[model samples]
Target: MDDKEMLFNSGILTEEREGAILPPEELWKNKKGGLVVVECPQRIPCNPCATSCPTGAIRPFSDINDTPSVDHSKCTGCTLCVASCPGLACFVIDLTFSDDLALYKLPYEMLPLPVKGEKVLCLDREGKCIAEGTVENITQPRKDRTYVIHVSAPKNLVREFRAIRVVK
Candidate 1:
């Protein structure tokens, strides 16, 4: 199958996909403030998410290929795992940041990075534009090229929008 087809079928998240792959809604609901969600589907040999987490939020596994299961109660939403994830499948969501909005943070490696307060297009898992989101913050260290972008969108779109596009 082509890359696009693979993305559409296996990687892209939907209600059905979330039900099958993601932790239950109660898990996410219990941690209403903030937490990390690992959308890693394929069981590749990766353990950076578990290794990078200083809080031990990601459960340990005997095999490096084991998919990460988050201990949301322990995750500080520090975003260390988000950058460490090679697949760029990790995300941090803050539901209590504001009454009207939720903060979404993800790995952004694209060039021509957007600045704080810049408006960008929020995209769903399928890369379809769903909402106009504002760039709240961008943290990029000289050592890490994969910048972490924090965006704020409607609270309802927290699960719907997983990415952002900066127009040149």
Candidate 2:
């Protein structure tokens, strides 16, 4: 099953089945400029996303089941959470990079992945491609399903891209 499916079956999220997050417009608008909001889908056994952080950005707060916290102040926009999160809930956002744009980093698990500078379609949380973007960066593949891809697109598309699509 996909991550969404697993999250639903595990009963960790309160949203409708397969839906784990609220609208960014409601949950994160006008918040801290660089704060990255993460939706913890479930309370499954995992804490690497918290411990793997070098700057202590991911807050453990003395509980393994607690959701991880990324302090944007010290995040450095590192992709460590992309590689460390067993559930793939982490993402990085840079709002100041462009006046009308934002950079997003997401965990990619599909095959025939994208490369740097390659133009690809950007999808939202529902897996719908809503914008075109250039792959500005990609994290090296490790022993897990985690791989972070950085995409640059128009500012409005910033909230729409939750996934990446390689152009045919």
Q: C-alpha displacement of 13 in model 1, angstroms?
A: 2.7
User: Candidate 2, residue 117: CA error in Å?
Assistant: 2.2
- For candidate 1, lDDT tens digit of each residue in 66-154? 87877776888788888887788888888766878888887899989999999999998889999998998998522564788999898
Q: Mark the regions of model 2 whose C-alpha exceeds 4 Å error after superposition.
A: 1-35, 141-145
lDDT of 2 by residue, 87-160 (tens): 77777666655767677777888878888889988887666778888888888545655888878777666445
lDDT of 1: 0.78
lDDT of model 2 at position 103 = 75
Q: TM-score for each prediction?
A: 0.85, 0.71
Best by TM-score: 1
Q: What local distance difference test score does each model get? A: 0.78, 0.66
